[model samples]
Target chain A: MRIRERIIETGLFFSALSSVFITLGIVIILTYESFGFFKEVAIVEFFTGTTWMPLFAEPKFGILPLVSGTLLTTAIALVVALPLGLISAIYLSEYAPHRLREMIKPVLELLAAVPTVVYGYFALFFLTPFLQNFLPELSGFNAISPGIIMGIMIVPYVSSVSEDAMKAVPMYIREGSYAMGATKFQTAFKVVIPAAFSGIAAAFIMGISRAIGETMVVAIAAGMMPNFTFNPMEPVQTLTSYIVQVSLGDVPHGTIEYRTIFAAGMTLFLMTLFFNIIGFWLRKRIREAY
Target chain B: MTRSAIELKAEAKNLNFYYGPVHALKNINMPIERRKVTALIGPSGCGKTTFLRCFNRMHDLYPHNRYEGEIILYPDKINIISPEIDPIEIRMQISMVFQKPNPFPKSIYENVAYGLRVRGISRKGILDEAVEKSLRGAALWEEVKGRLNSLAVDLSGGQQQRLCIARALATGPRILLFDEPTSALDPTATSKIEELIIELKNEVTIIIVTHNMQQAARVSDYTAFMYLGEIIEFDKTDKIFTAPSNRLTEEYITGRFG
Candidate 1:
């Protein structure tokens, strides 16, 4: 019996260790390549310079266009997502009857389960053309269509998380609000939403991170122009899309161009880490407020 | 004074409630008097809570819960069962406090001011006066006045419960319901809440559901003994404790059976 327990404990230990090992491996690889890239190209020029002419005779390694593109897409996706997601969450958690909630919650979950690649294909083939007819200036592969589709894909995440947060609010709080003669909408908006704000904020940050890290949809629907434009109607290349573009092309191994992908990957990693930290801090502050 | 002078503030006539096919409350007929505390005492699942919840239409908040017969609020001539009566409006006249202290995640002052703010009272002086008055009414003003800006959850359990009372009082309801309000509290907090309920009887008609027979005897002017969704006996508090009319009320008061 002791030997069996020891074996089970050892298995559990190794499983936990493997996760730490994988994270350490990613950090090491990102830092090593990032260090090598910075050695060749000045860190200041890489961060501040606007142009990214990597294949030219004299490569100008400016990463701002890629960062700006990522930010623009993320902003567009959030603008499309936040209000709709919150309202749907409120409907699901507060308004929907038990039978309807049982039916609708699973359908929303299924949306999250759909492959990101399928969303990419749908955005490219169906949505983009549908939009081009109305907006004649729309490009074949613009950020607008893909960002909107990506926003739709992310809606389930925000809604589900926010619903859980709203549901976790104590029943007595809603009762107290109702006892004061507040309507259902008022109770949900003023009392429940404020109480669940921290959790909803965390959900928003997670959705933003998902938008930033998404690759397939942006790669297929948003063209690899790497332009420093903020307009969603124009083609742009995000960090994830740039990585995909570089990996698909014939770039020599251990070259500066190849290392630049790792640099971009490092930037993505840091950006998400920054968002997670802020999200965690907000959650902590709200919890402490209670 | 004659029976006519004793106004029937609220009357439930042959009221029945069902959860799906299960009968939760059956043929409950009771008359609540004005400016008095009526204590409903029973075991868990005896339907005291369900009956109390029906007063404010809180039962409608759940799905598959249905009610039969009528609950009438006198003077207003409002049959709460009527479709024209808004549930929110009914709740404004009848407020409730739960067994657990549920202060909103806000400052002590804000918790009291929430109901007033909902009513569109925006002036700082009005809110400040209302908060102070409500807190004082709940017997919480002296303890919480200095730290009114502190989060309510930071208070002790007893203080938080008083803060909840203050919050309910801020709405200025005609009736107040307590569903085992002292059940989750410590002995000292229980006494404090009991004292506050007795004090509040002059301003609002109070209905309390309690498992503690001694608490019911101490705080109420009238006592209702319930069993299996029916009121077995109801009389003056002194008479119910000393000389109950029904054998079931006697058995329950003497700890013979729940």
Candidate 2:
């Protein structure tokens, strides 16, 4: 019996060690390439400078445009997603009957399983043309189309997490609210929503992280132009798209230009890390509330 | 008995309830008097909780929970089974305290003031007075007064239960239903809640479902003994304990079989 237990314990320990090894590998790679890139480009200019002409002779390596584009698209996606997602969650969790809830929940979740590439193609082929007919100045590949598609892709993420959070709220809270002569909407908004706010906040932060890490949809629909423009109608390039653009070309290994991709990757990694920390903190707050 | 002209609070006539073809409450007929404590004592699964939930129509909130009955509240003669009368409105007049302390994750002040706030009572002065009054009524004011802003979840289990009672009292309902309110509490907290219940009997008609036979005898003015969802014996508390009409009540009260 002790021998059998020893084998099981060894197996569990190795599994845990393997995950740590994988995480160390990623951090080491990101740090090595980032250090190589910083050797050629001053870290201050790379972070703070507005211009980003990397293929030129001087190769001014400011990455602000890419960061700005990423932020703009993510902001637009959140604006479109947060209200629609929360409302859908409230409806499904609180108002819908059981049969309808069963049918609609999976159908909504099916949107998340649709490949991001498919969403990119649909946005490029169908939505851009439709928007161009109404507004001729709209670019064929602009941030607006991709951001809207990304918002649609992320709705399920927000709504499903928010739904679970709302569902986890105790029935007694709703009962207490209802017993006070409050209307159904009042109970949902004033009582249930406030009680579940931390969970909802965590969901929103998770959705933002998913939006930032998204690649294929932004790469396909939003053109790779590293211009410092905030206008959604103009062509732009996000950090992920810029990395894809660099990796597609034959930039030799160990060179500053090649290492710039790692710099961008490191930046993306840090931004997502920040979002995850915030998400974890909000989740802890929610658990403490319960 | 001389009865006053005051309207009947709640009346159940030949009420039968079923949970998926299993008879849970059978032929329950009773009248709840105003501003008095009525205790329902039975073994587990005797449907005391079910009968208490019916007073506020909370049982109908779930699907596939059916009943063949008429529960009427006089002056309105409202049939609880009718779809016309709003369940929400009926529940407003009859609130419940659960077996567990399920207080919302809010501050102590907000926990007591939740029901009043939901009713759109936004005046801070009125809310402050109501919160203090309700907490005092539940015998929790002296302990929680100085730290009204503290999170209610920080309180002990007994304090949380008193907060829940204070929350229920804030609504100022005509009837209060307790489903084993003291079961989750310790001995001292149980007596505190019991004392509060006795004090509250002069203000609101209360129906308590408890498993503690001694608690039933100690706090209740009227006692009802139930078996298999039927009220086998009901009388003054002394009579039910001393000379119960049914053999089953005698056996169960004497700890022969539950």
Q: Which candidate is the best by lDDT?
A: 1
> Which pairs, if any, clash in model 1?
none
Residue ranges of candidate 2 with Cα displaced over 4 Å: A1-12, B1-7
- Model 1 achieves a DockQ score of 0.63
Q: For residues A15-99, could you state the per-residue lDDT of candidate 1 as single tens digits?
A: 9999999999999999998999999999999899899777678998999989988988888888877877888899999999888
- For model 1, the superposed segments whose C-alpha errors exceed 4 Å read A281-290
* Candidate 2 lDDT over residue span A6-42, tens digit each: 9999999999999999989999999998998898889
> For model 1, how does the per-residue alpha-carbon lDDT over B1-258 read when each residue is reduced to its tens digit?
136767778888899999899998889888889899999998788999999999998977777888898889977978776557788888878888888888888789988998888778889999999999999999999998889998888999889888889998988988899999988899999999999999999999999999999999999988888889988887889999999989989998999998
What are the clash counts of all predictions, listed in order? 0, 0
Error of 1 at A37 (Å): 1.0
Q: Please give, for residues B51-114, the per-residue lDDT of candidate 2 as tens digits.
A: 9988787866677787777888865788775667778777778878989887877899998898
Tell how far residue A117 is off in model 2, in angstroms. Answer: 1.0
Model 2: DockQ vs. true structure: 0.52
The two-chain DockQ for each candidate, comma-separated, is 0.63, 0.52
